[model samples]
Target chain A: MQHALILIGVLIAGMGLSVEAGLLGPLGEQVGHLSATLSIFMVGALLLSLALVFTPNRQLGTLFKQPRWLLTGGILGPVYVIVLTLATPLVGVGMTMVGILCGQVAASVAIDHFGWLGSEQRRVDGYRVGALAMILAALWLM
Target chain B: MLLPFIFLILLAGGAVLAAQSSINGRLGAKTGVIESAWLTFIMGAVLTFLLMFFFEPAHEATLFSVPKWQLTGALFGVVYMLAIVFAVPRVGTAAATVAVISGQLLMSLLIDHFGWLDNTVRPLDGSRYLAMVLLIGAIGLIYLSHQQRHRRMVNQPG
Candidate 1:
């Protein structure tokens, strides 16, 4: 039951960005993708900062010695918001989602296979490949 | 012709999203998840602030006048990003993503079917349900593969 609750929480949480889709459209129309993207980060950053204040945390300075790539991880979220904002109108939501899913699955598999970007390397075995194929088909079926 | 090209571009955008969990998850391992997320927002905020200037005339007046709920999108970003950072390392990025996507598809289907949030109501039909079932199957396959990999490693000689 506890596991089911967590899974349910994750599901509702997954809707966050999609729910944002409705709001961002008007926001995007008002300000453009760049400005809209800025707004989200600003709001998100503020919220996160407030949350961090209560939590015990590491010093950001230590991150400098770790490697440049770790610090660069911030770019992906803004990039996704910006790209999705721009692409959605051109392709429509359905195609944009399909495209995004395809890209995500492909890139994920590659990232796991190559172990790029500081992740543990996992080989793309036959089952993994087949699973990916099924995902693609399922996406098309959607 | 151009639309197909645009489709491919959108596809690549999706690919970046897939990488997002693992990237942040790894950062979480180093700085702790909350701090990693905090740093990411800081960097991203700086980056987008610069880009915002290039866009010019940034609807500042309109944004303030709009309902407060419209702006709550970023709060969701916080939850989703933090969750990804936490889930990725524990479950493996691939498996964690499958879980995330499952949630996403289900939610999206509801939004589509009921037209929640002022969306146009599109009835959920048989095919969409089938697609979802296939997705579950895909998730199963992915999860099974992870289990097998673990089993194999365990069986290997010390």
Candidate 2:
């Protein structure tokens, strides 16, 4: 029951993210995409800090000790948001999402196959391959 | 071979996002989810500031004049990440991702149809609806694949 409730939260999180994507594109239009991304992060960083007041586990040193590759997740956000803002006006949000999702699913397959970034390896079996094919077909249809 | 540079850019966006999840998951395991999120947000904010300062300095004098709702993007972003952080542990990551993408598609359809946020009006035609439906089906396939792998492992005696 707890798990089911968590899944519901995940779904709402998805909805919130979609709303963010929509709002951010226009915010980018008012400001620049990169600037808008920066603003969002700046604000998000501040808001996320409030979380620590409750959890209160200061590990700034541990964060600094991580290898460079693990830290790249920070940089990836602007790349995704910047491109999203730029592409939305050109391709429209619908196709832009399709294309992004295609890339995401494809990358996920490779990541899972190789167990990159410390995930458990899952071999690329027939079911996995078929899923990819279906996703590609879905993208094309979109 | 329809290789549009635009699509490629978006593709890269998705790939980086998937990679971020893996990296962030490891970081979360160590520092706790919200703590790691705070660190990543700091990193992202710092990097974006440097990039924006150097390469793209758009005028923000209008920022104060803009409606308050335009500012909610940041809040929504935080909520989204918090939800994912909380949800991924209970539900599998793939399922979480599918749920996110489903919400994105449905919302995108509504936004595009109404031209919300000044987007060009794109009617929700048959192809668009079919695509959404097919994507949902694809999500089922992903779950089935995971189940198959699980069953195979169970059948094999240690």
Task: List pairs with backbone clashes in candidate 1.
Answer: A103-B15
CAPRI quality of model 2? medium
For each candidate, report its DockQ versus the true two-chain complex: 0.59, 0.59
lDDT (Cα, tens digit) per residue for candidate 2, span B1-158: 33398999889999888777667766766666787688778889998988888988657645567787887788878877766655544444555566566666667777778888777899889988887777667656666666777788899955
The best candidate in terms of lDDT: 1
Q: Where does candidate 2 stray beyond 4 Å? A: A1-9, A56-61, A84-98, B1-9, B85-96, B113-123
Tens-digit per-residue lDDT, A60-108, candidate 1: 6666667776677788777877778778778787888888887887777
- For every model shown, the clashing-pair count is 1, 0
Model 2 CA lDDT for position A105: 72
Tens-digit per-residue lDDT, A1-142, candidate 2: 4544554566567777778877876777687778778778988999887767766656767876777677677788877877776788898867787788978877767777787777667777776676677667766765
User: Per-prediction RMSD in angstroms?
Assistant: 2.7, 3.4
Q: Give lDDT for model 1.
A: 0.75
TM-score for candidate 2, please give it. Answer: 0.82
| Error of model 2, residue B49, in angstroms | 1.2
